[model samples]
Target: MGRRTPSAYEGKGYLQVKASNGKCLTVPYDNGPAPPAGTQLFWWDCETRWFCASQLWNVVPVQVGTADANRTAYRFVNHWTGLRLSLGPATAGESGGRVTQDTCPK
Candidate 1:
């Protein structure tokens, strides 16, 4: 078995989450579904992609598990909407939800 790393997206910076198909997570601006906040996040080919303001995420470290737990995790907050990136169910074909400014679940 492989031991997971203590921290992955910790600290302040941009987070580019790559899919199994080698596409990076992106906030689409052209011909994409417009969320209430205006932009939606999606996966795109990183090599030939163009720059957009929504692509930048503010990485913030949050305490993992209980407060007494020494482990650390992170939340990717959108620089535009200030909403923390959230994941949906692990089921297949779920394309995730809109970026909303909500508190990080404990």
Candidate 2:
């Protein structure tokens, strides 16, 4: 779900999240719905020139059960794909990541 223009990714409020290892989170594919679930994710260098969808992530606050304390839990959703970052294919819920983009539960 990559856009032709970089309007959504430009200006303030957009951040390229990187890890301690110096690699930034990347989506790996650009074509709409091209990379199906189980597409291995990598922390590649961010595409600063054009600002790819895979480079930006949004930390969404989700509602969880009140087991002991009711606190907000967060899910990382890709700007373009609108998918969540899952642990891997085996447990891909909304289901994305280790980088599989599967439909997850509310």
Candidate 3:
């Protein structure tokens, strides 16, 4: 028999931390809402442990809603890491859509 693949896999998520020092870090987005205020998000990259921009400051989501068919934004901060992050103005990017259809063999 051929090599069997692993049946289980681990899920991963990114954390964007903002620091009170006016620094912003971009990592990954999680399913949760956001972190609380006054906390630092610490992550060890290589041998250095750093936090994101949002994790530095205390930023919370003023309004949490859905985005359009295009994109969305948010204003949040890291509680554990004390990172700061924000959602600025909205701008459009390359626009286009493609629809794929499948046909069964006759």
Candidate 4:
């Protein structure tokens, strides 16, 4: 029998992210609808495709399919600004090996 899977957007979706300019960004993606309230977001790059939030912050590492219970130290970058907020010390996780092709910057 196949193994049961969990929802990808569970618990981590909808995070209220703040930018370097003190402008809060409303993330509504499947990974995160909006970042958690009061989460600090540092501008890693204005063109990179990913960001890293605080390490202690619990977030779902967004992947293609099969939602898992793996919490990593990285938050997917915002698509609009093309900047990702670093979450942890930048450790290599399972989803880190996977590659996602996007036409956007960062």
Expressed as tens digits, the lDDT of each residue in 55-102 for candidate 3 is 232333343355744444443333333344322213123242221111
lDDT tens digits by residue: candidate 4, 27-50: 223454444422344322222133
Instruction: Tell me the deviation in Å of residue 3 in model 3.
Output: 36
Better of 2 and 3 by TM-score: 2
Clashes of each: 0, 9, 35, 20
User: What's the CA error at residue 50 for candidate 3, in Å?
Assistant: 8.4
Candidate 2 lDDT tens digits, 1-106: 2212246555544456677666676777756664655566777865656777777766677878788877789776777766766667465554342654444467
- Estimate the TM-score of every prediction: 0.52, 0.65, 0.19, 0.21
Best by lDDT: 2
Q: By descending lDDT, how would the candidates be arranged?
A: 2, 1, 4, 3
Q: Which ranges in model 3 have alpha carbons more than 4 Å from their true place?
A: 1-12, 16-71, 79-106
Of the two candidates 1 and 2, the one with more favorable lDDT, higher being better, is: 2
Worst 10 residues of 1 by lDDT: 1-10
What TM-score does structure 3 among the candidates reach?
0.19
21 Cα displacement, candidate 2 (Å): 2.6
| Candidate 1 wrong stretches, greater than 4 Å | 1-12, 30-34, 37-40, 47-50, 89-106
